[model samples]
Target: MKMIRNVAVGISGGVDSAVTALLLKNKGFNVTGVFMKNWDIRDETGNCTVEKDYEDARWICDKLKIPLIQLDFVKEYWNEVFSDLLEKYQTGYTPNPDILCNKNIKFNKFFDVARNRFQADAIATGHYANTSFGPYLENFKENTNVHLLQAYDSNKDQTFFLNQIPQQTLRRCMFPLGNYLKNHVKTIAKEASLHKIAQKKESMGICFVGKREFQDFISEYIDDKPGEYVDLDSGLSIGKHNGIHKLTIGQRCRIGGCENAYYVFSKDQKTNTIIAVDSGIHPALYTDFLITQDVHWISEEPHELRHSGVLSCDFRFQHRNPLITCNVYKISDNRLFIRLSVPLRAITKGQYAVLYSGEECLGGSIISYPGPSFFALNQQNSIIETRCCDLIALTSGVQM
Candidate 1:
């Protein structure tokens, strides 16, 4: 609807991003595809999977007749994303590296590389997210305020992963697939003679760890730090693990000859111990509050929180989990204290807690540590009735 603008589309060799480039071309924008190589490691089979992905990305660029640029961010990724992930793992924290990748690499370094190096007027990605800048940045104008929102396809919405990036970075971005469903994006790709790309399996979570066992891949980075499996109730050692990094909270770590199956309730890095409960759904696995010192707000801080020192909204620390009601208390400019409507299972420290008011993404903060578990509280006040539950109950499901 206006003068043609040069757009740098981050093509990740997937169906969604391939279609993203096609959409930009169809919209009369000067589309240029850039494929970023963030990781250089091969899989267990000694095959460089990233090479195959790059080939597919090249094919798409050829078919679309748009110039493709390849950028190597392996160094930046190692320093910005991987090192921190390893540190968190070593400390017995279950961190989501995807969100960090988005914040530091995609929206941060990629934005700078695309704009300064390539003369890109704007940036585009295959992410399923939207902005107040309009779906395609069609309504974007200088100095106008921007707000991140969930994609039309809520199932594939990636706003949680994007909540940490800077506000100005979002202002100059375009999400062409924001309003399109996964199937529809595939249909568009197929109709445009890019069916093979469309048929490519979607990349979920981290890509560098492709098809490799997480523990095996991670072992290459972190050494084996032996730890003990202690019973949460009796405080007795029931089992031992070669590495605490290999285990996570809420995971069923049952050992033979034990009186009952046990689930991980917590991890003590200093003591090199993994605390466990007899039942997977033991009340010890649930918590209703958490504190965080790293909180990022989009656009501006909410007026309600600024004035009243509190804000109630929907929250979910995990992307696939359903949004739950919560009240956010502003402890400081950089700190938050969140109280959930219902006690949730395995609310681990180091995971990001994203809060939203309806569809709009307000902000997110890292879960520094969870409050006392129901089991811990029961010892003091006998609040929750404990039970021996099955492994199936150990999920993100709410606990009343």
Candidate 2:
């Protein structure tokens, strides 16, 4: 008798995950659905959607005649993901908690539980990315040398988010929806009589927080400190902002009664001020070089970067522009300095700089700083000089 492989699927209460469980079940695997509860926070109206999602997950599992497992990672999420996110915001960096969540919680903790506790031979998800054993593994029966590839649906490819996941974890993972498009996945769900979930709108914003306003959600943890908004060109105060932490690079200013809409060009955390520009197309908003720390590679560091000293990169996920050809310089084993082929707009610090060669994701790092455009630096220098003069004058008057 052929032994059935036990596969655990992460049912996220969405059409994609529901379809994934269905596909795996049809393939003769002993399928189990797992729902992860990572956030317990409620919105301003005291509403929480976790129960609704759990209901949906249970409904899907019941329809499929499979068992459902619910696990709470709330404490783990707060400590590992939320804490790091708050610290990054305090330091004026926009960090991606989704990336960290996949690394620390989903792949690490969830993977461990499914394998050890549930005795699952493999774990699966609804992510739109492909994974396969690496070449030269035909002779080996043991799972080894896994490669994460771009999904068949380029529009929904999630390799960027999964770049930080380790190769070993990826080897034991499955993506049932990898080869299918989003519309096709919905079609499968509808055919399987999951019409309610098929038509359910996709969730957006942060992963765990669901649909809350970003500014309001962040303010709950970090206090709001009001600051001045200065025009970079004129070095004059234009408007007042609620707080520098509340804003991000390249965000539009809601400051009313302006002839032209202003965009956040830069931020000075020390001064608690934001610099604005009248036009989004300002040269000051773009940068050609960025320095990053804590870089991670999925399989191994690129051979070209080590041998030839250059590799192409995608600084941001789902970026519409062409891939950036860059020269990679190693600052340390875990840090890198990348020079881009073209200047990118709003290269925010604390964002991941994911690298790729062809269709393979090479992994990425958190951006420490974006090398500012010459025009932006000049404006900042002028402001610093004026502030120094003002301080000196104040000290001289005290002496007199």
Candidate 3:
């Protein structure tokens, strides 16, 4: 064990963090709470969210009898995270803000601030994740390769959003909530006379969106670049769309004049077009392969991958999805081609493809594109347009 005495915890006014700070204090560690001010905008309630959250954070600190510090990173957040997010959305990429937030704000900036400014022996967060170094960083050594592991509570594991965090940062980080379930954390808070905190509604969706639809929130930044929704099989115009940024792959598109509900299959930036297919697990939505770029490795390249230039592992792009068998081939230093054991539905580009070996999160990268769709695979045997039109007609109850 590193014998960490002074620990700085990132408190977000949530039940998880409250329990985390409580656990650290009970363990006899010198604890300080840090309130990070990343976004300064007001919510739909006409009050800034951080303001309300900060008040709650203050309450937790007072109850725990720990000193609290406030750090502002509004500028750093804008330049490092939000600007890149906006750029990606405008460029037809469905970027995840949570991933970017962990990579830039929480891990990068917070790590530096806690270690350098506050002189924390170890930094802690309420994230539902674990590490090879254990909670107190007992197993960490000089240049030790730390593996980000899944939480005991699978439903609450946050490793997906944290895959992009730097290795050095993970080495010194502690997740007190990792070994416990979400409900248990709430119970702990309640037992500590924090009933109000335990029962508070969970913060949902993008933190900055603040009670607005994603479409409405994003529209304020990007100009309306008009586009059309085209039927991928029929090559017929389904309807006009105000902007491609309004939707992403697998979303049930709300375009009118189409009897059958449609879902996006692809967004063509150059043509300003959205390729779509009728809903109901449409064959066009499934793919057997994906191309990824800018891969990040937690413990450098794995032996199997580096020695043979390929490795077999489990892959999951979305956090909620279960892991699937896959073979990842190195295309270059930071690029990879992944072959899935089974065709999966809605493998979205711009989303991450996280690789795993059992419980350890190896790393991940942004998906560049996917291989031939199920619809494409069947094209050689049948007339794609006619079959697709028939399927649409059948689903929508239209006469064939």
How would you encode candidate 1's per-residue C-alpha lDDT over 272-383 as one tens digit per residue?
9888899978999999998987889988899989999999999998889999999999999999999999999988888999999989999898998897999888786642
**TM-scores of all predicted structures:** 0.93, 0.89, 0.93
Query: Candidate 3, residues 100-171: lDDT per residue as tens digits?
Result: 889999898988999998899889999999998887676767667888999999999999999898998998
TM-score of candidate 2 against the unseen true structure: 0.89
lDDT (10s digit) by residue, model 2, range 1-400: 2232888899989999999999999988899999999988877778778888999999999999999999999999999999999988877888888888999988999999999999987788889888664211222234456677788888888888897998778877888778899999999999999998999989876865657777878888999989899998788888898877778888998787778889998788899989999999888888889899998989888776777655655555333445667767887788898988778888888888888776877888888988778566777899999888889889887432
Backbone clashes in model 2, listed as residue pairs: none
Error of 1 at 255 (Å): 2.6
Which candidate wins on lDDT?
3
The positional error of residue 29 in candidate 1, measured at the CA in angstroms, is: 0.3
The clash count for each model shown is 0, 0, 0
Q: How close is candidate 3 to the true structure, as a TM-score?
A: 0.93
- Model 3, residue 100: distance off in Å is 0.8
Better of 1 and 2 by lDDT: 1
